[model samples]
Target: MPLAVYILGLGIFTQGTSEFMLSGLLPNIAHDLGVSIPDAGLLISAFAIGMVFGAPLLAVATLSWPRRTALVTLQAVFIAAHVAGALAPGYGLLFATRVISALAYAGFWGVAVATAVALVPANAKGKAVAIVASGLTLATIVGVPAGTVLSQFAGWRAAFWAVAALTLLSLICSVLAISAGHGATEEPRTIRAELRAMARPQLWLSYALTAFTFGAVIVTFSYMASLLTDVTNLSEGWVPGLLALFGVGGLLGMSIGGKAAETYPIRTLVLGTGVLVAASVLLAVLAENTAVTIVLVFVLGFAGYITNPILQARVFGIAPGAPTLVGATNTSAFNVGNTLAPALGGIAISAGFGYASIAWVGAALGTVALFGALWAGHLQYRTLRTSSVVAKGTAQEEDRATTHA
Candidate 1:
């Protein structure tokens, strides 16, 4: 809601664009680098690996640094990494730089949650965080497709250069928007404390929900090019358009998700995940019709994304003290899902299942996630209700003591 959030959103947008642009340009990169498409795809895998390792590590490592400095410094590193990638002479060098750039990726995500919590009031907290995180959805729609297009015209290297410039701009925004006192206090979450939070049943359940919900989506979506050409009969040129369409739905879903957070939390997750599962099934079955396929893809993107903010907010509420750790872990959790989905989806396809079968896998995952949300809702209700009663009892005792005196 604040100006600062918009600035933070810009950083997220740039990060999302820079991170995913390669998916659209995979074929081009393979050709240019004189490697196989699978080898070129390693750049994406390397980044995910970085996040899995980097997200929580950055959360823990930046415990002492001020939040503002940490964010600025991370963006700076991101800029450098992009530039390095843009100028990289070989695939090995570029892949290594991608890993190095990912160091800041986790740090930014870790700090971004902490920053949002500090920026907003208790009720608007979810929405605030959503605003920052929604940048990912936008990248799906605008940034990635735009980057992909830039790749088509200029070259894959040029896309990285564009991302480098975007990161540079994000650096300026981070420097200007965040308050000086933002990161003044050290993070209080000790490793043990963070582990204790993780040990909670609700926490692991949330992670499970995150992994499968996203994994099913990614596995199918990763091979989306095949689906469009094989099933929908789209030209290679149209893949970017379809991706852009999905991105649009994702962005709209996030904006609406922020609003939805105010009235209901867990209920929103139920609705969003349900839509995603149903839509995935429909898309898989009816993809033969081009117009229907387009609509289904849009809805799939919208429904799948709306749950993202809700889940992150759920994690933060579950572990209020360890925002950085929980937040970073969830980010990694989604990527873990992303990493697993492709291989799993490929196996299903290799086993003679059609593209639509991936949707069944996704549907099963969503069903499991729905149950997870129900469980989380129960934990959340009990925890809050118990705390409320204790506070009321404490207040009554204090009142009686003061009156007697």
Candidate 2:
């Protein structure tokens, strides 16, 4: 793998920290902004909405731009958005900044995945993506917890300021590290061609898998702090450490998934989603047991992230026509899940089901994803079989013509 790939990861780390840190800071943000906790949680949904709308559009808009240039430009915008967020006067401005920052974040994610794939060997695409995605996991590990601590002491705004500074460092790293033409297309793709590529059913299935699998994770994770403090009887200080544990599990899961996906992409998806469903159900059942809850958090994180490399690689593998656009839409799909999961979780909380019910939501989504993965695999097999039959018929016709001649 190239140094450039890890640099993309560093960019993801900075951006991802901003993404997940909100989960931990929701209480502070809600109190300070005079909004209810659910309203603060809506900030997460707002960010997801931006990504859903921004990713594919941005990818198409920047279709002709060099990958490295797009990445650095997006990171710079993200940094600026965070600066605004840190200085935001009230909830409304801060909410607006979240959406703006997410647009840049989504654009960066799409380009970074494309660039990371372009930088590596054909056989190593999964590993390359995992390496880049590790930045997000590491953000969970280092950035989120650190932000939570900062938010705990100084203020939530302090965490945003730190994120802005770290993002600036990432932007500088990207400018210096990524080669000018690292992932540029020789000929720019037209809008029609990109749209045509996105019309494939198999590609859509991959998107569904991304949505459900990731949504399952967010359903529980979006309100994990409340669960820990309210149900598990853990002090607020323990949330960051436990969140770090989840990150550690994610790191391990991605490593395993990345390696396994090289030869067993569909199988990896099946296994990961299966584990997610089971873990989520079990977490729901045992939500009150502090020790079991802690263990399940790690399990849930591992299962949630393990499918990432596989699904991402699957999208690129299946959509050879417009790799960048497909990757962007895939990012959108994940955010769609992100957006819906939290909103649904909030509904569950408001409906008197309590925080533990979020795990059941996760379980349901993961089950849907598992079926989606199985269907995708079936479709892939049928496509391969049809191609083989057509090839054989073509060969026979050629032979008959040669004999006649």
Candidate 3:
């Protein structure tokens, strides 16, 4: 709603472009870097690895820093990493840059969500965070496909350079939009408090929900180019357009998700996970038809992301005592899924399951997440009913005491 929230989204857009651009550029990167396509996909996992480990560590490391300063500094590091990526001389160098860039990107995500939440009222946090997440959706819509086209024409290195420039601009926006005193928490939390918050079982359930939901999506998406070309028989030129279509669906999903997360968080997860499972199954069965494949890809994207805001908000809800750390840990859970999905997809591909098998992998993961979501919903309902009973009992006792007095 605020200008600052949109600016935070801008920062995520730049970082997200770098994160997902590789999906479209995998073949180009593989050829240029003299590695196998599967190996190039490893770059995606590498970036996720950096995010998985870097988020909480960086959140703790910057606990005392001004939030705005930390946000800008992370973007600066992101810009430098992209610059290095643009100039990388070999696969090793490029891979190193991917990890480094991801570390900064992960740190940015931790601080950015915390900042966005901090800037808003309790009722508005889901929307604020969703606004920030819209950047990633927008990246998929514009940035990723654009980067894919640039990589196709000018080479993958050029795409890296473009990302660097965008991030620089995002950094400037962050500096201008975020208020001067916006970074530090109103009541600074202790390290022990943050740690204890992480130990909650409900928080871990949220983590599992995050991991499985994202893993289901990534497994199918990581090898989408191969599915498009080798299976659907599409031309190289069509890849970016189809990817952009997927992004459009993601944008639609996110807009709906933000509002739904605030009003009906559990139902949102249930509906989203159900859609993902069904879509993945349809994609697997209908991969042979080009028209069907295209439609299902859009459905998959929409369903895959419909729970994004809810999952993020759910983690924060369960761990209110450690909002920043919980948010960062949730980011880690996302990347954990990102890291695992590609690896699993690669294994399926290596085993000669063909590109279509990726959809099955997604379906399986989505099913697991669906069960988790149902379990979580059950826990919430039980907790609410229990609390209601206790409150009613207390009220009756208070009334009796007042009458006697």
Q: How many clashing pairs does model 2 include?
A: 0
Ranking of predictions according to TM-score: 3, 2, 1
Top-TM-score candidate index:
3
Q: lDDT per prediction? A: 0.80, 0.88, 0.88
- Candidate 2 structure quality by residue, lDDT tens digits, 149-253: 899899999999999999889888887888656654445667688778778888888888899999999788878889999888899888878888888999999
* Tens digit per residue, CA lDDT, model 1, 10-123: 888888787777888899889988999989888898988898788888888876677887888888889888888888888988998899888788778878877877677778
List TM-score per model, in order. 0.91, 0.93, 0.95
Candidate 3 Cα deviation (angstroms), residue 26: 4.3
- Residue 121 alpha-carbon offset, candidate 3, angstroms: 1.0
Question: For each candidate, how many residue pairs have backbone atoms clashing (under 3 Å)?
Answer: 3, 0, 1
Clashes of 3: 1
Candidate 2 regions with alpha-carbon error over 4 angstroms: 30-38, 395-405
